[model samples]
Target: MEIKHNPQLTSTELATLWNTYMADSMGRCILTHFKQTVEDQYIAEIIDTALQIAKNHIDTITELFHEEKIPIPQGFGVNDLNNNAPRLFGDLFYLRYIEHMGRTGLTTYALAKAISSRKDIRELYKLWYNQTEKMFDMAIDLALENGTLVKPPYIDYPKEVQFVENDKFLGHFFGKKRSLLAIEITHLGTNIEVCNVGQTILLGFSQVANSNELRQFFYRGAKIGKKQISTFLGILKDNNTSYPSTWDSLITDSLESPFSDKLMLFQANLLSAIAMADYGTAIGGSVRKDIGVIYARLMAELANYAEDGAKYMIKERWLEKPPQTHDRYKLINRKD
Candidate 1:
């Protein structure tokens, strides 16, 4: 199909492009900083690929916005990064960071494609989806090669096929409970690993944050991350499964600010939103009543934390507004 750019972009198309551009810009800044500090060649290559994609995506989005006569968002840039600063984390952190980010990018881009109607918007999101999948694969391979990837617990194969005959299939709240399914275990392990990665990065952010309030926010995020990680691990232990190891010890004692506070806070907020959404999914996929309740409670906590982070961003005037329709009422009531 010969695709032509529509003179006007739909709201969905506009929002998707605007969000992707802002996110890619922030990602580029962070990856650029990581590029300067990463010592491993394999990890560096992955970051390089991701960084190039982000830069190219930002440029394309900028041109699209300009053609549409829409003002471009002032996203993060080199000024938001300090490449000469001391390394705040070890090489392992960068690898795991990419792993977490790649997962998010795949999810976001797919959803963007689904909601987009314009040919240009659909094609761009599809391209991003494929690109992010490759990036995710690289992250997983590098992590496995480095022995840093968290292995999910193994389960015994069923001796014979069986069908659920009673309510016990859903779960038991009072009596003895059936063992967790492998799928359930996979989601739990993945969420736990994500929290672990977030905690480690937040710990490093807390050390380098310049604003006292932002630093406190990072500390709060770390504390919540620690709690969530333990909660998931406890659930796994209840089923006699081995929990993944922590990566917190990989962070150094460097107090230098390698990233601007705006970049750091935006990242923290972004991860918090992603964590809450994943927890909701884990809850839905879970059969255990107790685990679902746990996810619900944890999501509430994360929602509250994310709200506070947004307020801080607005207070600091650092949050950029996304695209919206013009106010007809305001225009009609305007004073000359």
Candidate 2:
């Protein structure tokens, strides 16, 4: 129950404790989507993989708990599921959800590995991290295969741009000129548009979800996306850049559709995950620490939301089985 950064604990104990907690958390989240429908076989397979990973971790942790005389933590159950949840989004969104969850999972497990002192725990984290990486890669492959993943416009390298430095109350502001701002602003606008589209899918799904809990989850996510959009807009404003008016107009034409609730949730999760990665990269490229900090926070928040959503979908049995790798040699030999 009480986990400390205690030096006294054994490696197995630590790994068991951490994994048990995570497994239970993930299980609870996934169980929410049990009995929900999936439109795509590939997406469904990926969801299954996500579920398998959660279930595997839970099983492992449960065994460890029993061996250690520690009571097994209660995992996710039918009680946590919303079988009657209404359809809130289309099928395209479900694929996006798997993609996002994979990215978030990779980042999270990597972080856990870095902080883990125990060798066994580190190895376990490594396994999960690798699994997440594979999941992300597969999602990308699937997206490319399906022609759904959006690629940002490529810009040729430009040399020598005039950047201005302005001193203000809080801090000194320094950035590229108005013309460059225009370019950056344009890209930011594109990201915002993608984000809005994803959020719309989620909102539509939440509106129809039969379970109040699932509905609330999607509603909360919509609010988060709105707040993030506003934050991004404020960043543009501070830089004397015009925010895109397109986000407001890119509304979903229909909230009710043939899409299952699980699929809708999946799509929403994927979009948010992609946004997190894109925004994080954007922040890293910015020269200003303040701006970077803002973007970083946004990325973290989005990752959290994606993870939460993925957990619920898995619990509800809406996820698909992930592709497995046979040998390292096979992977190395595969054509790019």
Candidate 3:
């Protein structure tokens, strides 16, 4: 396909295109995984709905690209998948992955809507965002039904500190002497590192993606990471903690090529999940309820994003299949 430069493609337009492409590509990948592992008819229905949304978006964007006479970005296709591979995870873990992905999709769609300028693109985003929101709700319900969602320990009030004085357990030893402010500072630093890592990954992937939409998605994600880093720094300073030095290492600099879409999505989702867990732990350890709440929300958002990415990986056959358990066998001959 001959590529044409459409100067009318504003930054926002480019971003929307990128998000649409990524979402569609990943969604198709996850749907394949769901078809192989999901047992319950109801749960399968929900997964199907999500798949439909992704497919629809892909079609819509393709049409848009055609209308604009712009070349659509090349991404992973059905040929890249191997859905019949041996299961890699249990059914419970698979459900958990889907639940997380739905949440992530919602966040990404919402962010895209906020930044997009063209009415046609914004309208398309609104439609997909609503679809993602529905998918998230359905995933949560399915997770609850299947008992797969992780329930964080509920704490009603602050508890007394108990120091574990063991040199081998570095976390325990360091945690004992650290004030709440100090711990918050450490968490802030970690968050900054995660954001930087994510940005680098996205930037590297963006440079290699053939689709304009894919590149834009990475750029948008990079922008979001920058904002998040700024926010964390502000919180650190407000709490009278020193901000950590900026991350200067470029993981992508040594690489000459772009990552495959499946690989990129997998890495992004995995990183987001790790960050979510870290943020959640920070919230639990923080003394300030307000700060805790903020971190908690951010963690939730990241969790959702990671889950979405995981679903796509599964569909693409990049991830392993979840395991299945059989019912207990009856003792047919023991009665004699």
Candidate 4:
């Protein structure tokens, strides 16, 4: 992709580039480990593709930052990776992880493209978004072939076009409620799967974390994720709808840390942030008042979890500050 000369990057463009750089850098470290640890040839190929994409994004973002005279973030790298550590996740988990990440990348890059005014930046995001779409398709295809993908529950086809006749369709507080709407079921099933993934990842992190404090934090996160999964699952059970299978059983008993404490903490917090966003989306898509209420409550818990993780990162000096405007008040107070 050729870069056209333009004015200084807009705040939204800078924010999106900086965020993508940080995520991809961290992803590079994690994917490097996955590529090294994976045994299956087909899975290894997918991991390699993901790792290359991460590295390419990091390089492109660094180049853009240099051109714009913005300092690059000190994102994760070889120093934060443990090449000798044993694998913490099973081969199947790698596929699932890639699929999940690719799914997220599509959303992130689409939004980045939408908010960007610079032609070069918009094109970059569009390119990456397409790449992610292909990557996600690959993962999904393989998962389907392996019979590892847990699909959303199917609902009977509507026999005819029907209109709501009563306000009760919105759900009731005391009496018999209506069956789950397709959108409601979709969000509930998706959130349950995300929680399961978070729970398993945190469980692996907790086992290998070096600091006791970090270990406890990861354990607590895993426990909360497990509870959230159960809550969603219970809702599905009420409708007799099936949900995705849990990934906890796929975690290994490895005690050796594959990633630094800082990296692990960042990843855990990132997952929590994603969960909160997912819940908010769910709340919006849902029509049932009770379902929305449940999502709202979960969002609050996830917010607290993410905040604590941010504080911990700050305390440890592991959090890298993003680009921001100069403080006008500080400038005004300057004596020189």
Candidate 5:
């Protein structure tokens, strides 16, 4: 296990590094603007730490990409941010944003570390995972301290571990459907939480975006997010469970552009992608037919939305070129 081979990067390893770099680049620009406009000193410190972590990862990943001879992605940077623009969101929302991002980071790095092959890449992801985990913890602490943290629903402790007795465990299309399993509740709660965060961000983005097309795209995404939130909340209410807190009121009325249209579109697209992944995971985890079917529909909607967002990005030439396979046909037909 100690042996280190400088072998060609596997597709999975390459993907994990490449994707992280792209997301991290966006995070760097976002947090930079956040750090500039933030008024609360406590929230400022957390933003600074997050910005530092994102910057470090971008630097490290760029080096790795260069060594592997893979083309670096044209991710966001100084040109994508306008820090002098008025604040689009308040301090509380900034902290809440960090909290949502921390949770996503933990999940992302964990998956990346699991799939990485090369020793160096695995080690790198592990380092990022540890750092991201720390950030999650700090965000949680800050959210709790600031009274912004939303805990999942509280259910009574089960009497004992009991197996499913019959077909009723999966529920039905007729009368008297079975109740939700604890695991099902967990996944539902998780999706709702992340969806709310997505909705909140989309709302703010739709408000201050400069380009009309970008504004429309964000508005469309926000509408989808709102519907998704309603679906999740209705499910919880039907099953008699508490819902998580909403930060929709945290947004400001500022119409000034804080981020470039490119940055805004990319962020919207990135979060929608993550939301799609989250729904897929939820479908896999839920055993209930209804839950799975609902998530499948939600995932489909997200896919369509993402496709539109990608086309918009392409039209605007904001889409970054990722590392891809060589064109064998083109090489064979070359005039040279």
Candidate 6:
């Protein structure tokens, strides 16, 4: 008889699974609220789909943790939510939020699948990626049908293939520079949209956060988001390119807290982290020296904001520690 041993999950697999579980749990709570408050039937359908996906993720991760004998993370749950709280966002915001989640979900799942060594882990992420892709497509189609999708600025089609002539094509630091490339325009427009989402969500959080400190933190974050939006919009306008408008109106004036302060703070931190990642990506893709400088500066600001959030969470004991390798120094120093 041949004997085969099942391989254990790697550190990368464990970390990814833990993070996914936490995020999905929080997502479930938020989606549950959206499902209850959303008015449009079509938008409600999307919320229901997303809520189901989040629930399934929580269940699957729990099973995996049980099999591995790993203590399941105490992620967000019903206690963190106030379902009877009045609606804090418009239906359009809910739909747009789902679309943004789908995009980020694709990025996260793709990275997890690529880094996973265990066959089962890779297969799990692959399934999630495919499912999110479908959801992303659904969102785009629905947004178009509803006439709410704002596309990137259009440019005249190139008549013929052309090549960069000299270093002048790479934009300047002080003097007049070359026109923005299509890719540069796309990045600016994308960052604008992302900032709009962040600002709107933070604005809502600020209104309902329980503590004054939490409210201040969210208010500052929303301000940063608004500043970033203005910067991007100014760039697009200077280049004579059209850009998408902010979604500030999507937020309602509801002061009742729908989510716990911990959840709200975590979400604010998450959005800042995502914005930083996106700014870094924009820097990598941009050739314009000025544009790269702008992205770097914005990313630094976000880093500081995120650091403060981390400190606050740590102080409040709201941040859960992830798995870490054993401390070799402590082990060696101990008398046994």
Per-residue lDDT over 1-336 for candidate 2, one digit per residue giving the tens place of the 0 to 100 score: 444543444554465455445444444354235216565677777767766677776676667557656555443345435455443444555556556556556766776778776665677778877877776787688878877775443444658884456533223336442332334555466566556665665576576666677879888888887777777666676666556553332224443443346645655665676677678667655555566677777788888888888888789976543323358997889999
Clashes of each: 0, 32, 15, 0, 0, 0
TM-score of each: 0.94, 0.57, 0.50, 0.96, 0.95, 0.96
lDDT by residue (tens digit), candidate 5, 1-336: 576567899888887778888888888988887888899898898898899999999999888779878787888888988878888878877887788888888888888888877778788888888888888788889878878788887789988988878877887765765677777778778777787777778888888988777778888888898898889888888888776755564788889878888888888888888888888888888888888889999999999999998998898788877767899999999998
The C-alpha stretches of model 6 lying farther than 4 A from their native spots are 1-5
Question: What is the C-alpha local distance difference test score of candidate 5?
Answer: 0.83
The Cα local distance difference test for each model comes to: 0.87, 0.61, 0.62, 0.88, 0.83, 0.89
Better of 1 and 2 by lDDT: 1
**Candidate 3 per-residue C-alpha lDDT over 1-336 given as tens digits, one digit per residue, 9 for 90 to 100:** 443443465666675576567556765765665567666677777778877887888888788878877677655566535555433333444454455566556766777878876666677778888888888788778767765544322223447886657543322322233333556666677677667666655665566554566567656666667777788877765545656555433332332232346655655665576577668777776765556777877777676656766675676567643222333464544556
Q: After superposition, how far is residue 87 of candidate 4 from its true place, in Å?
A: 0.9
Candidate ranking under lDDT, highest first, comes to 6, 4, 1, 5, 3, 2
Give the residue spans of candidate 3 off by over 4 A. 1-7, 157-336
Q: Of the candidates numbered 2 and 3, which has the greater TM-score value?
A: 2
lDDT of 1: 0.87
Model 2, residue 120: C-alpha shift (Å)? 1.2
Q: After superposition, how far is residue 242 of candidate 3 from its true place, in Å?
A: 28
- Candidate 6 per-residue lDDT over residues 200-282, each given as its tens digit: 89989999999999899999999999998889998888888777766655777789999999999889888888889889889
Off by over 4 Å in 2: 1-36, 69-71, 84-87, 158-221, 230-285, 289-336
Please report the TM-score between candidate 4 and the true structure. 0.96
Query: 266-299, model 4: which lDDT tens digit per residue?
Result: 8998898888888989999999889898898989
Per-residue lDDT of model 1, residues 1-336, tens digit only? 775647588888888788888889999988888899888899899999999889989999889888888998999987899988978888888888888889988988999989888877788889988998999999998888877787777888889998889876888667777788887898888898889878988888998899988888899999999999889888788888876776664788888899999999999988898898899889879988878888999999999998998898899899898888799999999999
